[model samples]
Structures are given as structure tokens and as C-alpha cells.
Target: MVDDLVPIFALMIPIVAILSALVVRPWLRLKERQMQASSAATAEKAAQYAAQTERLEQRVRVLERIITDRGIAVADEIDRLRDDRTTDPRPLN
Candidate 1:
């Protein structure tokens, strides 16, 4: 009787595997989509951060140039800008 059951068990194994694949395929596809979306969002955020960093670096370079220049003219220019701001009568929107 055990020998007779061996063939039956062998046939059931493939059937069970097919049924499991049918049941799990959709779940696997959904997880793959989620991972793709997460990857895209991460890339977008990294690009935004890179752009922000570049802008900050540019500003830092400008400030360094101003500080490293050998002249009282830079101080005079900064003071003039400050005075201009106080004298401006335009209403800020």
C-alpha cells in the first residue's frame, strides 16, 4: 500500500507547487511594484538634496571670495547694502 501511494504523492507535489505559485504570484508582483516606487522616490529626494547642496556651495564660494579679498572696499559695499535696506520705504508683500 505504501508503494502504491508513492506515485500519488509525486503527482500531488507538482499540483501543490502550481497552486502555491498561483496564490503567491500577485503578492510578489505587488511587492516588486512597491520596491520600484520606493527606489524612484529615493532617487528624487537625492536629486533635490544634490541641487540644494550645489546652491549652498555656490553661496559659500561667494562669501569666501568676499572675505579673502584684501580691501576695505568689501566692508564699504556691505555697509552700503545695509544702509540701503534701512532706507528702502517699499512695503514688503
Candidate 2:
């Protein structure tokens, strides 16, 4: 009986190897495609964030220039605008 069981066990090894090959290969391919799609979405989001950051940086640079140039006053101008609003409640044309 033991001698008969040896052949069965030996036969099962190749069968198991073939079954796993059929199953694992397709599963690996599916995972690879999923990873590629995820990476593409991430790259798109990164590009959008970079563009938004650049626009914000440009606005900040413009503000800094206005503040540094002699033509603009921060606090006094704000007060003047506030006074104008109170004196003339009408919207400018």
C-alpha cells in the first residue's frame, strides 16, 4: 500500500505545479494593469497640483512687487478705501 501511495504523491506534484501556473499568471497580469491605471491617475493629480501652485506663486510675486514698489501703500490705502465706501455707498459704474 505504501509503495502505491508513492506514485500518487509524485503525480500530484506536477499537477499542482500546472494548476498554479494557470491561476497565478492571470492574477498577476490583472494586478499589473490595476497598478498602471492607479499610477496614471496619480500623475494627473500631481500635474494639476503643480499648475495650481505655479499660479498661486505668480499671484504672490505680483503682490510682493506691489508692496515693494513705491506706488502702493498697504494700511493707508485700505483706510482710504474704507472711508470712501462709507461716504459713497453707491457702487462704481
Candidate 3:
């Protein structure tokens, strides 16, 4: 009986290994794809946030320049911008 069981156990090992692999492989692949997709979405959001930050920084710089300047320079810059008809009227993105 022991001799007979040895061969059965040996056969069971390979069968169990193959069955576990078949079951786990698809789950691992799905998890990997989900992680990749999540990473891509995070990267996209980060890029958008970076762009928004840069735009805000530029606007803040322009505002600071206007506020720190003397009265005549500040007025001149506003007038110049108003007179530049070819430029886009909306500065904020």
C-alpha cells in the first residue's frame, strides 16, 4: 500500500502545481494590468496638476510685478495690454 501511494503522491504533486498555476496566472495578469492603468491615470493627473501650477505661478508673477511697480509703470502696462488687440483677451487657462 505504501509503495502504491508513493506513485500517486508524486503524480498529485505535478497535477496540483499545474492546476495552481492555471488558476493564479490570470489573477496575477489582471492585477498587473490594473496597477498599470492606475499608474497611468496617476501620471496623467500629476501632469495636469503641474500644468495648472505653472500657469498659476506665471499669473502670480505678473500680478506681483504689477503690484510692486510704481504707479505710472503699472498704468502703462495695463494700457499696453488693452491696446494689444491681436493678443488673446483671456489670459487665464
Candidate 4:
């Protein structure tokens, strides 16, 4: 009975090892692929954010140029009027 069990145990060890190797090998490969895909997606989103930031920066520069051309004193007056509108507590009847 001991001899019979010894051969079965030896066979099972190799089989279990092979099965685990087979499963883990493919799982690792799939995980690597997922990582690569996620990295690409992240890079794409970063590029889009960079482009949006650049456009916003350009708009700010244009606004600054216009304000400077018009003069700070005039711009301040306009800002004061805008603030007045927001601060007015009176309801429009």
C-alpha cells in the first residue's frame, strides 16, 4: 500500500506543478497586456490635458493683451460695475 501511494504522490506533484505553471503563465501575460493598454490610455489623456491647458493659456494671454491695450484704469472701472451688479441686494421688480 505504501509503494502504491508513493508513485501516485510523485505523479500528482508533477501534474500539479505543470497545471499551475500553465495557468500562471497565461495570467501573467494577460496582466502585462492590460498594463500596456492602461499606460497607453493614460498617455493619451495626459496629451489631451496638455493641449487643453495650452489653449487656456493662449486665451489668458489674449485677454491680458486686450486688457493692457485698453488700460488698467478702464478695466478696473468695468470690474467695479460688474461687482456692483453682483453685490446689489435689491430684487428686480
Candidate 5:
């Protein structure tokens, strides 16, 4: 009886090891694929943010040029008041 049982135990060990290996291998592959997809998405988002930042910088440069062409002083108090008022706020003293 003991001799017969030893062969069966040996066969069972190999079968269990093979089954575990088969299950674990696919799980690792799926995890790796998920990580790769996430990295790709992050890269795409970063590229879009960079493009938007560049566009904003270009628009700021255009506004600076327009202000310069119009001879608007950067520190002029009267110009600041006029810009803040949608309608004339002149007071009669």
C-alpha cells in the first residue's frame, strides 16, 4: 500500500505545479499589458498639455505686440483707469 501511494503522490505534485504555473503566467502578462496601456495614455495627456501651454504663450505674445503697437504704457495710471471703466466715470467737481 505504501509503495502504491508514493507514485500517486508524485503524479499529483507535478499536476498541481503545472496548473499553478499556467494560472500565474497569464495573470502576469495581463498586468504588464495594463501597465503599458496606462503609460501610453499618460504620454498622450502630457503632449496635449504641452501643446495647450504653447498656444497660451503665443497668444500672450500677440497681446504684448498689440499693446506695444498701440503705445500703451505699462505703468500709466490714466490708462489703467480707462481700461477698468466700461463707461466714462468722470466726476464733476
Candidate 6:
């Protein structure tokens, strides 16, 4: 009886492989698409962070110029910037 089952088992291996292939290929494609979308979102976030960083750096440069230049009244410029910010509640970018 066990010997009779050997041929059956041998045949089952290829059938199982074919069935699993049919199921797994679609799953793998779905996973690959999900990863691609995730990476694209991450890249978009990185670009946004980079732009924010650039904007902050520009603001820092402006502050440095204000503080270092002797001709401009630093206190008045600072007050003016504060007033501008309150009047136009928008990001410098």
C-alpha cells in the first residue's frame, strides 16, 4: 500500500508547485507594488523636508545678516519682522 502511494506523491509535487506558483506570483506582484508606493511617499516626504530645511537656512542667513551688519538697526529690523509675521500669517517659503 505504501509503495503504491509513491507514484501519487511524486505526481502531487509538480501539481502543488504549479498551484503555489499561481497563488504566490500575484501576491509577490502586490507586495512589490506596495513597496514602490511606500518608497515614493518616503521620497516625497524627504523632498518636503529638504525644502523646509532650505527655507530655514535662508531665514538663518537673514538673521545673521541682521545681527552682523552695523549700519542696520538690528532691534528695529527684528520688530519689523515680528510685525510682518503677525500681519501676514504665512510661511516665508
Q: What range of 10 consecutive residues in model 1 has the weakest lDDT sum?
A: 66-75
Off by over 4 Å in 4: 1-12, 72-93
Decreasing TM-score order of the candidates: 2, 6, 1, 3, 4, 5
CA shift of 36, model 5, Å: 0.7
Q: How close is candidate 6 to the true structure, as a TM-score?
A: 0.72
Q: Please provide, for model 2 over 1-93, each residue's C-alpha lDDT reduced to its tens digit, 9 standing for 90 to 100.
A: 999999999999999999989999899999999999999999999999999999999999998887788454776798898998889967788
TM-score per model over all chains: 0.68, 0.80, 0.66, 0.63, 0.57, 0.72
Q: Residue-wise lDDT of candidate 4 within 24-62, one digit each (tens)? A: 899999999999999999999999999999999999999
Clashing residue pairs in candidate 1, if any?
Answer: none
Which pairs of residues collide in candidate 6?
Answer: none
Q: In candidate 5, which residue ranges exceed 4 Å CA deviation?
A: 1-17, 73-93
> Which of the two candidates, 3 or 4, achieves a greater TM-score against the reference?
3
Residue pairs clashing in model 5 are: none
Q: TM-score of the candidate numbered 5?
A: 0.57
For every model shown, the clashing-pair count is 0, 0, 0, 0, 0, 0
Estimate, for each residue in 1-93, the C-alpha lDDT of model 6 and write its tens digit. 999999999999999999989999899999999999999999999999999999999999987886888446877877899898889966878
Each candidate: what lDDT?
Answer: 0.93, 0.92, 0.90, 0.94, 0.87, 0.92
Write candidate 3's Cα lDDT for 3-53 as tens digits: 999999999999999998999898999999999999999999999999999
Model 2 ranges off by over 4 Å: 90-93
lDDT, residue 9, candidate 1: 99
Which stretches of candidate 3 lie above 4 Å from their native place?
A: 1-5, 71-93
TM-score of 4: 0.63
Error of 3 at 27 (Å): 0.8
lDDT of 1 by residue, 10-74 (tens): 99999999998998898899999999999999999999999999999999998888778845888
